[model samples]
Target: MLHKGEAINIAPNVVHWHGASHDSRFTHIAINPNVSQGGAVIWGQPVTDDEYNASRS
Candidate 1:
């Protein structure tokens, strides 16, 4: 887990998902270059409850 002030850089086009603990709050900023040109974000399938729950293990 990331500590305070730590950050992760995800390369463009890489698939990833981020979330916080159920009892805590989390926030982040996303900077997408040239997003005004369209298609800067391409979403994939939804993360299911089972999948999400398992990830916390």
Candidate 2:
């Protein structure tokens, strides 16, 4: 489990996504060092709650 002030490393091409609680405020600082090397972010459609829960099992 992640605690406050902890961090993790994620490499390229991973299926990871980010989110926040419905009533909470949050922020993120993203740096794309790969931008100059022809790297681009891959975008996908947002998954519905039903789809997310189904994947959990």
Q: Which candidate has the top score in lDDT?
A: 1
- Per-residue lDDT of candidate 2, residues 1-57 (tens digit): 456676676688786777554444345455668987876677678968876566446
Candidate 2 has an lDDT of 0.65
Model 2 vs. true fold: TM: 0.54
Model 1 worst lDDT run, 10 consecutive residues = 17-26
User: Which candidate comes out best when scored by TM-score?
Assistant: 1
Error of 2 at 8 (Å): 2.7
Q: How well is each residue in 1-57 modelled by candidate 1, as lDDT tens digits? A: 878888888987788887665455678777787688873888778867876677467
How many residue pairs collide in each prediction?
0, 0
- Model 1 RMSD to the real structure? 2.8
Off by over 4 Å in 1: 45-57
lDDT of 1: 0.75
